[model samples]
Target chain A: MDNEMNYRKSLNKSTNKKVIRIGSQNYVVNAERFKEFKKNVIAITVSVALAIATFGYVKDNIKFHHEKVDISLEVYDQMVDKGYKPVPADGEWDYRYELLDGIDPFDLSIYMGSEDALSILQYRGYESWDDYAQQEGYKNQRDWYNAQKKKVINPETKSKGGK
Target chain B: MKPLAVGEMLTLGDEVEYVVMSRLNHNNKDYILFANIDNPEDIVVRIEKFENNELCLMGLENSDEFDSVLKLFGDQINNSL
Candidate 1:
């Protein structure tokens, strides 16, 4: 309390001027008017600080309310039955899948003939099938390719490879 | 056969093109979530199995299996947010 009083005293002493200068003209400063002005400024600052704190609290409360509602198994079944699919929030699609120990079973950079795919493989430092297969924990290129092939169902190439 | 990357669209036996939304590998089994191209809301979740190197989408016949997958997917989305 003593420290706060001293601080306020210092502030007042610094701001309270005896004379006001207006374009080379000196006028007597009104102490009452100066005090009122300072009071208003302080009030406005407090009000703004309070408003910001309240906003943050309300936003957190709303987020907590949303998290409280757990989707039960029955509710999930009903949603699927009604043809409503689970949709992730924007920019959060990457969280939908867990790439089993950093090994992506769906990564087709090895099989794609496109330059874009080749660039991706090169970017990953894989110069040959041997490098890719070894890095991917496969014994060889054929084994890795065979394992990955079993996960894909391409209708366009179905008749060609008995897929 | 080659690995079909996620987000790729392909026609099925019904001749309806569907978009592969995502894949979830849980409990030693792989599952795929897909949606009809025309109506994305019309979605389906199926067990992805390879028999004799042939990929097949099998319907979730067991209710418990379906429930667990649904819960796992729901929890993941919630936690991500």
Candidate 2:
């Protein structure tokens, strides 16, 4: 029993030493170096506090105004009801109709026929599809329309019909 | 008021878990409650809170109504905890 008690005491002492070592690593400071440590801590705390204050101020003020822009399902539906169309999922516009309009064909198709699309186009300063096409440097629509037709009609069918 | 560490601020895309704290009033009679989410720093969110000792938490992504967010958060927390 006495030997067992001694072993337990040694174990406790080792455990205590390990805890002390860990605690010292986290919180212990030398008395002689206290002034320098205190100054460093104060500087770090002040800088961190200032940064936080500035962040809070900016977030509460300027950022809130921009972040609060309302984008709701109702608003999206309303835009659609107003004759705007949604952009295609693949982000490409179908420009086949533009080729028939006698406008230049190389103009990237705008996702037209939706309020959202119109709003986006208008926001980008496009008044009409023609204006957008002209800006993109497409020549007149006849060549574009012919090319589109050829793409739509199979070449084999055309050859068979000709023969 | 030390600036929160980079890990403290909730970013646009982050998965977090939180605990409901208490309700607080913002402006006028409008009250908002907050929860301490599992962020590096305690994220005091306004969209969720506790009522009558019942926990409530909310989701910002799928919910537009504050109440819905609170309900969802509460339910999720309850189920998980």
Candidate 3:
């Protein structure tokens, strides 16, 4: 009976030693450090995704605007072809300068052409001469052209017309 | 096509402000002429000298009216004095 008890005690001591060795070798990783690493990775991924989305949106908007301007130009040309007459100012004028406010100059010039005076008159649908001149840019261009008209003379005699 | 007379007034379409002048020929028999718009500067052009036709243009200062004017009036210039 004494021998059996001593054997059982020895067995228990060996099992406890194994359990301690296993627990020491396999350590649990630091939960706080792991969480911080995951957060940084997520932040970087979100930033990159946002940047790509922004770039795409900007590019698409520019393309859409350009196409819209192009379509507008085509419509204007069609209107002109349909017997739309330009309403002239009071007197004969020379070069008319129409100022386009709050618009892209290059794009406006391309689609509308350089004759801003005529374009405005056509756009406004003014039938009579007086109604057309009342527009802001129309009056300005007409006035400027009128001032310059006196200088134009016959190339041969360099004299003003008798009429 | 006949050459543009001295007193003839050719109205360039809505975009431009110029009249066709008399037609002359270049070295290649291409019809060309002097034009005067509202500006004092005399512009040389090649145009068809029609009696009462209007030519539409885009820009007054920098226009391809000269070329179009030439093509349209080249034949008329050949017939002019």
DockQ of each: 0.01, 0.04, 0.00
Per-residue lDDT of candidate 2, residues A1-163 (tens digit): 3333432332232122211111112222345334443444434333333332333333333323332232233334443554434334576543222222322122122113334344344446678544544454434234333333343332332311110
Q: Which runs of model 1 end up more than 4 angstroms from their true locations? A: A1-163, B77-81
Best by TM-score: 1
lDDT per residue, candidate 2, B2-78, as tens digits? 21121121221223322223233333222222222222122233322344443222232221233233344334333
Candidate 2 positional error at A150, Å: 52
The DockQ leader among the candidates is 2
The TM-score of candidate 3 is 0.21
What does candidate 3's lDDT look like per residue over A33-124, in tens digits? Answer: 33543455334333323322332333334445565576457545544454443232564322232333233322333345435545545454
**Count: clashes, candidate 1:** 0
List pairs with backbone clashes in candidate 2. A84-A114, A84-A115, A85-A113, A85-A114, A85-A115, B18-B37, B57-B73, B57-B74, B58-B69
In what order do the candidates fall by TM-score, top score first?
Answer: 1, 2, 3
Candidate 3 chain A minimal-lDDT segment of 10 residues: A16-25
- Candidate 2 clash figure, as a count: 9
lDDT of 1 by residue, A93-157 (tens): 22212221232322423222323234445555678665677677777666666554433322233
Best by lDDT: 1
Judge the docking of candidate 1 as incorrect, acceptable, medium or high. incorrect
Give the clash count for each candidate: 0, 9, 10
